[model samples]
Target: QLLDIARKYPDFPIVLETVRECLQDVYDVPALTELMRRVAQRRLRVVEVETATPSPFAASLLFGYVGAFMYEGDSPLAERRAAALALDTVLLSELLGRVELRELLDPAVIASTSAQLQHLTEERAARDAEAVADLLRMLGPLTEAEIAARATTDAIGGWLEGLRAAKRALPVTYAGQTWWAAVEDIGLLRDGVGAPVPVGVPAAFTESVDDPLGDLIGRYARTHGPFTTTEMAARFGLGLRVTADVLGRMAVDGRLVRGEFIDDLPGDQWCDAEVLRILRRRSLAALRAQVEPVSTAAYGRFLSSWQHVGSSDSTGIDGLAAVIGQLAGVLIPASALESLVLGQRVRDYQPSMLDELLASGEVMWSGAGQIGGSDGWVALHLAETAPLTLPAPAEIEFTDTHRAIMETLGHGGAYFFRQLTEQASESELKTALWELIWAGWITGDTFAPVRAMLSGPRRSGAPAHRQRQRPPRLSRYSVARPHSRAADPMVSGRWSALPAAEPDSTVRAHFQAELLLNRHGVLTKGAAAAEGVPGGFATLYKVLSAFEDAGRCQRGYFVESLGGAQFAAASTVDRLRSYLDGVDPQRPEYHAVVLAATDPANPYGAALAWPDRAGDADTHRPGRKAGALVALVDGRLVWFLERGGKTLLSFTSDAETQRAAAAALADLVSAGRLPSLLVERINGVAVLDPGVDAERAAVQEALTGAGFARTPRGLRLR
Candidate 1:
């Protein structure tokens, strides 16, 4: 029967061996036969039900999946071994026959036990106590009269009573007669996983305890996680207060920690200091071991879909807030944020959605850094949780101008743009204001300034409420130089210094690291580093490594060739490996789309470097700039458009890839993902030239194939 089961798992030795050993070694064939007989006789009613998740009763089974969840020390096994001797006559006879066993002794251990024995009873005339103990070990369940007759002692009863008092022996009723057995046989009568018997107690702990009771409890705590007073009391036949008092003393001695160590089992619990450390390490290691590695390309695609970019639109304020929250610390150009970034993630995305959030104090925008033609790229964070990502005051290097603005807001409170610019030029005030925003010290209460910045310089008398047409063609120099003025501020919302989240940098680093894991399904040091987190990736690394130790995050080298440490949420690691699998072959091809260069979904220029550009290295490599864009097919970069939107860089010069890239861009415009894109130039030349470079002509053909219309100077998508 066992052979048949083994055959079913021929390639899995562990499973086969475990099953065989469990039935044969752990439980005898007789036990199995009895269980089967009961089923045949209908004595047992078998109940079975399927569940989508494990039941609470499966807690013990979870230990099989994670061995560290349960700590098994020497005591449980040692007690079981002692019990086996009492249960078998042959083992008892073997011990009696071995005179050599008595010779194997540690004097220090014996002396220690003797010292504790003094506390149980007063000293008396010495008797052959060793001989009496040996007799109990070899042939216990001996009555007082019978023991006295064999050892020739008249006072055997008094001696036996002392031994029982010291817990060196226990009384047993055998054949309706009272007899004494050594405490080593206690395992045969133990309740749960076995408790501390004489064999398992070491000499080291004997000195501190007046008796064996403390040793027993200490051994149990060493081998288990946080347990309740009731649990310990029930196991050892003691009252709750007695158990608590003992544990309290142990805690006072710094031997055990008293607190809620287990999450679900709340209330005061006690655990050994060393045991907790091991528990954390083992739990994390087990979980970390469950996830497999994936390629860098797969990781990139995972982020694209994970963040919901270039996919179906998620509608409503909840969806909008979720997208903004995911991109909490990401900085992109003010122009691309609404027209490109939001449009990619939210359905029918409008400026009003963001304005509503800003107005209600649900969301606020902060300056991330200067990039593209954007005076500076901006990021939106949930207003309530913004303090968590904001830099500490000491981390920010403020100029006199920055300090001045901060001082005013710190004392006077949030001010509107007009009020803030009352004493200084709008441009000058903005320079210091945006600097503070990027430093994470200030936020805007309204999205109007961002709307104005994306709309280009304000028209000569256009009202602040007036909506403009098509936001002027972004300049060739929309490498939009600052013009000796401050970068744009999130002007409309009232401005004030951001409050600090936690004064401790380490705590904030941990939260930020956790956020990164959730933001990107998988996080690498490179991704966190690119965010310019305070103290950089190194600071977050310490927190991530600790999380791995605690089993909150799994650390691994998941993405191929993207070197250095990588950490991912346990579930996402699985999703990344099996991304969008089993889709229909007949459906229209998906997974190709255009993304903002600064979009968090685009790992390039951030988590992973932009694919190498062979000859145009000096033509300004692609970056996470506002006006720049890139096309990806199944998460691999295909084509890149420079910030100026004039020069185009093809990662792969192949026709199919170029066409796929163009088709994705055209669909974006057709689906209103982006309003429109007119390509005026390619690789520093006019988008089209009659009889121009044949190579350039192929790009045009790919674009035309993707529904692009040819114009006098370039291609335009409708």
Candidate 2:
């Protein structure tokens, strides 16, 4: 039996519960193990999944599908990239065993690199430092390997070595690896994907007891509020045992308040003191209202204590010079750069380090003696401080998409992004807009719904009502050219629509799914249809199926318009029977169109007849007899009539029971027991079989006397 099942589901992961059930009669663990081995050899691989919750493996599965894994890199960029690809759990024990891809190691990035390039230019003594500065300025921070990949000159290694020897660059370490950047651009070496810029911890922070775990919990509770140990472990990658221990210790320390799990989270949870106070006056009313935890403030606090400890090798003046260079000619508050440059507080980010540059007249400082805070110590390079030159607007190559965008602006109005979505393909519109910006024709930030989605809510302390308003314009590049003329003489600034990139059905489906999920938080076939996309319902289903596989959402059924017909399983007919049996007929949420068998010879038979569906009687039978089924799931229904006389059972039960029920239903239909006849245990009636012959005689006699004509296949309708 195990072998047969394995053969049948070769591509899919085999679950342990299935194996246990199949071999329940076996008493020995060894016997079960051997059977599993044989089944696996037959190409049916079993995956054991361990979980603290039902969907614990889902995150890992999603991570694998996206070609990423946890802790793939120690740096923020690498970790953020990994997390963006995570899932959860199971028949979890079974899933835990079968999942071979569940690990934090990243294969994709590893596979992309062959061998690390060996450095050739030994010791900084032999190379030219000036040459290194030119390369560093153009490419930003780079690893030694990356430097080699981009450099055109041989002994590029020697040049990098020489620059480090001359103290022209700063090498910052992250995730156990070092990256080189010019002194002013050390922050650029740090990835911004994780955590906000580190700042000085307030004096208040020093008063609190400082256990890293305790601090993490306190911050979690404050920002996220009332989280289970499992959630904390998952979020921090601290392991469940460690998280639970820390939570327990923190509770004992009186830094955390323990409480019962809220929502569906398991185990007792801990809440921040501040969060507990807020919860006393407020409650989350629904699952959808539950916000995912954010630890931005906590992370900022953690980094604050460790800021600016490293220095560039050049004279102290060069380190100061590097900071100014990173500012890119923009004025930055002195206090802000204090900790950033020297790992010192705002009051201590001294001007003494700049004395040499001041004496040499290479750097200029404004607002001297203003005291070091928000408005103090503004500095600029003498060359950069000079008035900037404006370049001539030269004619450039324009794609049709570029022309369309210019034409839209040619209307001489600032059109919102939504207004432009209809005019050009999204991808092309974005490309054109940015190209125009780079060309000095316009400026603005592009709207990116996907990127915005990653940051669940705004963090800038905006009001709720304000946050609900459309996203702010990123940058306003939509302003017309100097004279409102296209840089190209052939192009006129007129709103002439042009053909855009061909729509990719796959991409469209994914986008539609995202839009629907973002807008509604739930998915139903009918809702997707109404929302509409490139390939309509067919594309929507494919995308949803893919999401289900990746553990993004759970799949269920929605039966159409049958009030209160929502069921979790897809065996629509069986679900219908189950729902109707327990449902109260008088309930406002219940609606049913029951079609009872009619006795044609009886006067009441003609009156009880169901109307034919909207077509000729020969081709279309009434819905009751036409095998129409409605699927119900979470209060939504999708109704459609079966075609080709085939009933695709959306089973709402276990695999075995579903199969049995389907076979029985088929047998009943083939034996003429259920073309249209249905038995209902209504309030006042007893349904005695009344024997098989009696039922057949009644049906035949009724059919003959009723005006309904028998078709050539010996089936009667109408």
Candidate 3:
């Protein structure tokens, strides 16, 4: 059977032997001895036994028994040898006792015993099975028994069974009810059995009373290595009072090296090799992570004590110093140190506590007194700590004109010329110079000459023939004369070439009409006729002159009837139109527009009228008569129809139009699709849209829909 079992599992070890006694007998000594010998041989161990009767030769032969007869007799040396050999036998026996022998015995009895054992085990497992069944029933109907079996076989099942047995056997009663009943009522059965109650004193009290002197000694030696009591106490968490006694005992026992108490060691003082190696290998990041959570006050106390023990002489200490110095520099700049001191009633620092640090030159004074000589003033060099640099100027993209100016400046260094000319024409030079000055590229003081040349008074009283003739040139004899002074020719020649002024009654009448129009806003035909103004001549000539001098007007006019400079006019019209387009009246700019519109007879409206007002009287007339002005009443609806397919007014220009427009605007505002009127701007004019109230209503509705509450002014999201 053993061979079959070993063959079945080829990796398993097997042993076999023959015995003189009947194999089936339970207590056959010879057979047992043979079996034990085979067991020892297979396991590679020695076995020994002592004989009652002794013969030297027989004993030697007995000791030579290869399988079942190994033995020793009581001789003085033999007893010692027997004891030595028996130790292995005893150890093997103890090991073999731990292994169960039932599987190796008769199968019928084994099967019967196992069945009985399984019955008991099943009885123990039944409560667990019930719990699993209950849990499965709660979840859903079982899909299969095999799946349910897995839950029953889990550690929780074992725990549940144990708990059930414990509760049944030991029913602990508290407060007039069984503890088990309370546990079930509270659903504590889900987690399994409660811990067993401890007898005698509590473990916490016992552990506290038991001195951990050995552990403390070991930890102290490891952390403070080769240190005396004073140094050890200062460095470690152990209090100084008790540390000296422990250290003295440890020194007497030769566990520590006794030494003279020199608290401050030199920089090169040796420590335990292991400690030095650990310090060398410790990473900065790891140390920072460990120490960062330690409060600054606690760290300061530790550092103060550590300095006293001469631990600050290492490179790690130097690194820490540098870190602290840098931190102080940063924090001092950000924090108001004087204010903190004045505000808080902090404890005064102890002089004795800081004595070691001061004496060892680890601490230094950093206040104004440290500066010395000039009132001991200490000034921080901000530049040394944090430097600032100005941002470089952004490069600007240049146009062709800008590039030309740059090139001209580069060549000319600085120009003194009143005008820059592309060509030598006086008009071109004046135009270019004016453009440059306007664009801020060139500057000059003398604009009078250019201005006069462009628009100036003409000379009068010269005959037509004389005006037409060119000025005379200087004689060669006069130029060749040694000291003959001549009138400044350039000035004389320019003055001579000036054109004579024309004095006509027609011109005078045109000027007079223009002056009147400039002074007053009226241009009545009756007044003109009363002044004997020819029907077409004065008006046509005046209009032409006005057109010529249009560029000189401070407040320029645009003929909206002629669309050349329509932007400014269009903007003004659009601003007024937008305001009338249901703009919020509460907005400052919108209110201004509303006030302007309310006047009805404002002169500014007439000024804004188109020049060809007679042709399209309804469209171009000012005030309510103008089509644009009337459109303002329903402009919101009109704009909506024009801008998008949506209709602001359902009823087209009827009694319902206003109501429909208001409803649509209110809906839009509610939908959050429209901005508040107070903040809206149109055509450089800020106007609140009338839809703002509607928009607020819409926002409130949305917020309420999204599970919020609305107050009078706004909605609260929460």
Candidate 4:
């Protein structure tokens, strides 16, 4: 009955509006039908839960609304909002194309949408001369025929005459057409003359008599990118010159920005201020997404070659410094750093070159990890950024002797051992010096501390047989003076401590992440953890992700099995792609490069885990320790020599590969990587395990052929 009343009395606003409010806006019939269909077909389920009291949503439905958003509905702020909403209704009563850009780049779709919106704007505009004048004010510049057609009347010519005589409108020649615009907009429309004309729009007139196009046009501009006056006019079904004028007014009012927006389009264009920011952000995102993923094997081999392992591509002291920068914050033994790590990278990495960098203060070393016995492992850092890169100091036990040495050095000058001994005995001072060094407080002017730190019972690369060959000194056992021994190579360099760094954690984290990328072309949580990076990959992850957002680097699944959580500098990704594995299989030729088991480039036990021992009962497994060695044959781990350099573990069962692995160990000794290697066991068994042709005979034979002497206990390299 109410529906019948509403239909009969169309003039009664309450009845029809109530029906629309309930069925059209409040309760959507189509959605309700879809929900019912889903329930009926069992595609969705419905359940009822009885609560102790009415639920929040149920109470809302029962009371309709609890209160207004503000304290009162009649407040001044509320009154202003209500006024704005009322004005918005008239402005949006006939909206143009949707703000969402569906056909932003497609010309055909844009054109069709343009025509439909133009026709809609014309057809919906009010039908009168004052309304035409307002259109000129809002979206104007129309010929007489255009105004007449838009107004759907033949009397538009008469309206033009009235407007012209009243001096309310002016004419302008634009796009080879004389179009009339409101007199006030001449500054933005271009120079004008005496003229009057009009055309008609479609027949869907709006109820409003006082239409303001400023707010309407401003809202429309936010939906798309840069557009010219002609393009916007055609799309909106308004006068081109008038559209440009309105756009210009908005630009002057700081609501819009004018420029040559679209690169290919030839003309000045205007875009919404916020819209330009959106466009720039989207462009950066598109560019950052252009990286390609590569396989783990390829990335591993690429890293090996990139760090100059097994390759002699570096030269001079500058090259040595670059390698040190790459190795910053990486903790490795001082001994292996020169013999194995740096030597593996630079072509002719002489000790003299490193001494030069240390002497020049271009590179600095600070003890980091508590890896090697009492002295610990050290991390190399660039002299400039060393303060920023230094990790938080760890607590250490300082003795009186240590305090005396530090006090003497704290006087601000480097001191040799003999000088510091004036305050303490030589033995006491030497022990105290290393304690301070391991505490990360002191360093030597030369590399002597590194040598002294290695001077423990765990001998360096000095051949055991050569030690016995040294003839006994015939000189008297008299008190030695500090004469020519001033430049002693052992431990006589001047010792001084670096001021403790009080770093900003955030700044330090960002810097560490950048250096991490510089060290490893591709960074992964496992690899970062392997290096024992402070706070682990979790801390660096935030900075790296930020780098990606800023387009400084890329984040992607660059290596298989390393997880999708990976980040790399842009150049790193380029180099990784330039040598994809399958693209040219034989290019990075297979050479057995031996790396300290703890070297970051070893990849095994870092990016990749160690293979299971050959026998389940085997007690020892491969680990990344200071004194151990790993040999990679084309980025595949085939040998793991334990830190003691006695027990050898083989990852492969191939006889020839076994020989290759042992031969590589021999080559390591030949390259001065080790004084000698004594292999007593292979894969948890004796090298010649019991039988004439032992189970691990191949390794024994290979070691012997590589100049290893057969000692009573094992195969020893001389």
RMSD of each: 30.9, 38.8, 42.1, 22.2
Candidate 1 lDDT over residue span 1-718, tens digit each: 5454435444433333334344655446555454444433553333455669865547657745574552222112222223332232224335753111111222233333333322212232235666667666654335666566555557776777777777777675433455566776454423222333344433442333233456667766764555778787766567777788888888777677665544445446776756544443443343333233455667767888899885566777888998988888676777678867888888767878898998787887777555544456677778777777654543467666676787678785688655664566666777677667656677776777666665566444667678456557576655555444333444656887666656777777878887898888778767877777888888888998887756776676667777658887556666776653223534424468788887788898788887886576475567776678898877778778865446676676567767888888887778765666677766556776555565577777888898878877578776
- By lDDT, highest first, what's the ranking? 4, 1, 2, 3
Per model, state how many residue pairs clash: 3, 48, 9, 24
Error of 2 at 144 (Å): 84
Which candidate wins on lDDT?
4
Better of 1 and 3 by TM-score: 1
Q: Estimated TM-score per prediction?
A: 0.52, 0.18, 0.15, 0.54
| Residue lDDT tens for model 2, 594-624 | 1111101111111112322232333333232
Displacement of the residue 339 alpha carbon in candidate 1, Å: 2.1
Q: Which 10 successive residues of model 1 have the least lDDT summed?
A: 98-107
Which candidate do you rate higher for lDDT, 1 or 4? 4
What TM-score does structure 2 among the candidates reach? Answer: 0.18
Best by TM-score: 4
Give the TM-score (vs. native) of candidate 4.
0.54
Report the poorest 10 consecutive residues by lDDT, candidate 3: 490-499
> What would the per-residue lDDT of candidate 3 be over residues 1-718, giving only the tens digit for each residue?
3333234444423332232122355365555555544554556323344559855767766645631222122112222332333333224435753222112222333233333322223442334545544433232112223223434353453544454454421223222233222122222211112223323323332223123443344433543323445554433345656666665565455454332212344221122324322322332222222222222222222222222211233233333333223222111200112111101111222223222332333432122111111111111111122111111112344545444444555554344332222434433443443344333233222212222332233343478776656437665444455543333211111100001122454564555454333311222232233223444335634554453333212112222222222112122222222222122433312110011111111222222231122232232223311111111122221111111111111112332333333344333335333322121221112123344444333432332443434333333222
The residue pairs found clashing in candidate 1 are: 431-486, 445-493, 446-493
